[model samples]
Target: MDTTRRQALTLALASAAFPAASASAAPRPTGVEGQRRADLGDGRFLNPVLAGDRPDPNVLKDGRDYYATFSSFQYYPGVPIWHSRDLVNWTPVTAALKTNIGNVWALDIAKHNGRYFIYIPVLVDGDRPLRTYVIHADSMKGPWSEPIDMRIDNMIDPGHAVGEDGKRYLFFNGGNRVRISDDGLSATGKIEHVYGGWPIPQDWIIEGFALEGPKVLRKDGWFYLFSGQGGTAGPPTSHMVVVARSRSIDGPWENCPHNPIVRTARRDEPWWSRGHATAIEGPDGKWWLVYHGYENGFRTLGRQMLLEPIEWTADGWPRALGGDLSRPMPKPRGGSGGAHGLALSGFSPDMFGTKLAFQAPRGNDYLDRVKLAGGVLTLKGQGSGPADASPLVFVAGDRSYEVTVEAEIEGDTAAGLVLFYNEKLFCGLGLGPERLHAYRIGQEERWPPGAPIDARRLHLKLVNDENVVTFFHSRDGRQWTKERSFEVAGYNHNVADGFLSLRPGIYAAGSGSARFANLTYRARGPSA
Candidate 1:
């Protein structure tokens, strides 16, 4: 064998054996992994049932299939729809709304009569006017129709309910209701103040009188309305789930004797600021409630989807079964089939339409920024860094995982993978002309001993364990070099306040575009 080839092989083996030699070493835990609450399938499940940054869950059950969507907000490919057979496990089915409608908030997903409809509430620029838009699809996996502006201004969180008169209506925030047209396409009548929300005690430390997230259900001649109050953030005890019910769809609603059905009464609890719930009957005919909450100190994970079994009292009021939601309760029974979540580690050329999505762009300009071929993704550079580039990202549920992608900068531009949280707060490492740039908090710092890259192809990897992130790069895909590491526990809602989580993403920014290839992702446990 040639001496040069033998030396290269020896170096590769040495780097693999020594952690210091390989720059792409996995990150150590930062103590946040213990808070997750999903069935890890290891005879144990984690808390927060749905982890990461999922918030404002709206769930719909179609026959045995259950579909759920949450507030996508600034994230494009708005209205991501998830499917599940058992309420416990969920997987992304499709991103329902592709067109940029506006900054989307809490939405309602329901199947009325025969069609599936999502009532979206968005804030348009001019007056900061809140409008609800309607989109329908024949099937959950949809060729969803374009959004029809309902023109119902100054309202949010549209909950669909069928009245006793066999007519459709929408219950919105601020205790308001509007009658819907027969076809459920548009509004027919004026919005009216319906029921005043329940009041909380004055001495109880809370956020504010934020009457929001009204969800309705018709059960046994009674129409039940579930609403959240006391603002979404502030004190840990703020943001609670409250209920009121009435026999008729219209008036004289009675508040639940136990008005606040679920709340974080104390800060010591594992989850904080719990509210915004949707209730449903489980497959076993048992009652269940799905809601959102910030996990203890890990507010950076955003408000995650939480599942708890509900039991009805003889008097017909509902109660939560999962205590404080910090511990595992009994899993719901009788759910037999369906997958949980899409594994993002592996990708083919066709992965974009399924497992991968770009962060929602303001305009449609970023749509043409990416091209996939032969299992590789080539992304054109945009913005100057992660913030403006609208980095291509995927939601990762694990608390600890590593993602690596092969990248080749075509011009004087730069490209790298990142854990991005909006434009202002993000951190990652990028390669530019003869130097490596380490970014944090919207600012870039240069790293010494950077690799010289005249060639177009380079491999990059990021390992985010808990909130800590580390970056690495490779030239020949064998030997590696660590670029920089950062602790990002504060890149979350409490500090940044976008109601978003720090997400795993890739960015190509600077002068020219970059071609990315062979993206590989892996979830690591304590051992890894």
Candidate 2:
């Protein structure tokens, strides 16, 4: 611990976790009606028990129920199963990979024996090669079962184990290990490197030496493993959570003398590049961990899902009692609480729910080009803008929000509302019955005087407030117009590379059809 005394105890723990957001104040982050509710209803709780861009979180539990899932990168309804009993409320259960196949990352979600699996790790794009897939389910609200590509290449974080001679393994992401076939879908060999991680201190400021998320956990007789070391997004104390154990899953492991058991060490911590973790068991039995971070300056809200509380130690090891979470605590005791999120107020236009599904960063085959009847929704045009229009997004874990919709156009479609982040970055406001385009960092400006949206229905509104967005439209919902505002904190993933998160979505694009209507959303509050 000497890089000038660990940078002076990381600036005294970032001046006690309360001095980082400053460019005049900055630090809004609150959520509930627009989602981001980490309980806090009297019994206390808060620390993203799942919020925007939930990265690498993979919880399982089954039995008093708990299920979680994240890292849905290109987002196509990919890996979305959430549901909780008392792991601090949660909802949405369904979307077990409706085929997009690429860019998805860190998943695991096991159930075993009675069945229910999900391994995934795609990343395809460009120089190709990087695979690992598997999906299965006898029930977790899913018929789930199409992936199966375990052709296992370059690896990216799998971690599903079951040994003590029961066989079946998956481990991976540098410490490697494979051989899993017995109904858990393919791969039954090749890929063993077996444990070499946990050794970080050489000047320590880190963001490299990327060990990657492993998450094994067997308990009692011991198999443990839990990983992710640095580099899961750069320095705010680059990612942590480490541990190692092994009474026998076959190995000489053993490294948790309280090793990194959860980190963030400072940057005015309110969660920031925390770690990958995943160690569950708590419906009353206690012991938790489940991780992912980055909320400090709201890394555009990308690495969320947090939940802490861990104990163990009487020589055994586990520790991370949840500090740096910034506030509220006590809430995970005896299960039984359900219904936690979803209802970004579409203001009843026949209300669709699951936050108004439209997903397509790649496939769902455009749901046969969409239609949605009654409360409108239309769609049909395609790539002429917003990076090849695949818009329909929704996973807005609030940090100030507003969204609105209406749009109508029919023959030369343009359709509106966007915030998107993947068809090569995004920006919003579209309208086309005459003109009003805007999109920003990903191009498409056109509004030089703009006033003609001469009816094909109108009304647009975006308003992020925290990220400073603005832009409005309206034609009859009472006449309004603003037009542009922009800011969006560079639209995330460090100037957009893909671990996405900026979504707000809706897009039609070129030639013939576009409907959308009423839409709504709401939230507008915290961001500092």
Name the best candidate (by lDDT): 1
lDDT of 2 by residue, 347-461 (tens): 2321222344444554657566776554355778887876787777776666776766566768977778888777666788787777777787778875547356465666677
List model 1 lDDT by residue over 69-161, tens digit each: 999888877788888777777776788877887888999998877999999999878865788899999998998999999889999989999
lDDT of each: 0.75, 0.73
- Tell me each candidate's RMSD, in Å, in order: 7.4, 19.4
Q: Candidate 1: list runs displaced more than 4 Å.
A: 1-37, 40-46, 343-354, 446-456, 526-528
Locate the minimum summed-lDDT window of 10 residues in model 1: 6-15
In model 2, how large is the Cα lDDT of residue 411? 90
lDDT of 2 at 152: 83
How much is the lDDT of residue 498 in candidate 1? Answer: 68
Poorest 10 consecutive residues of model 2 by lDDT?
Answer: 5-14
Report residue 29 deviation for candidate 1 (angstroms): 21
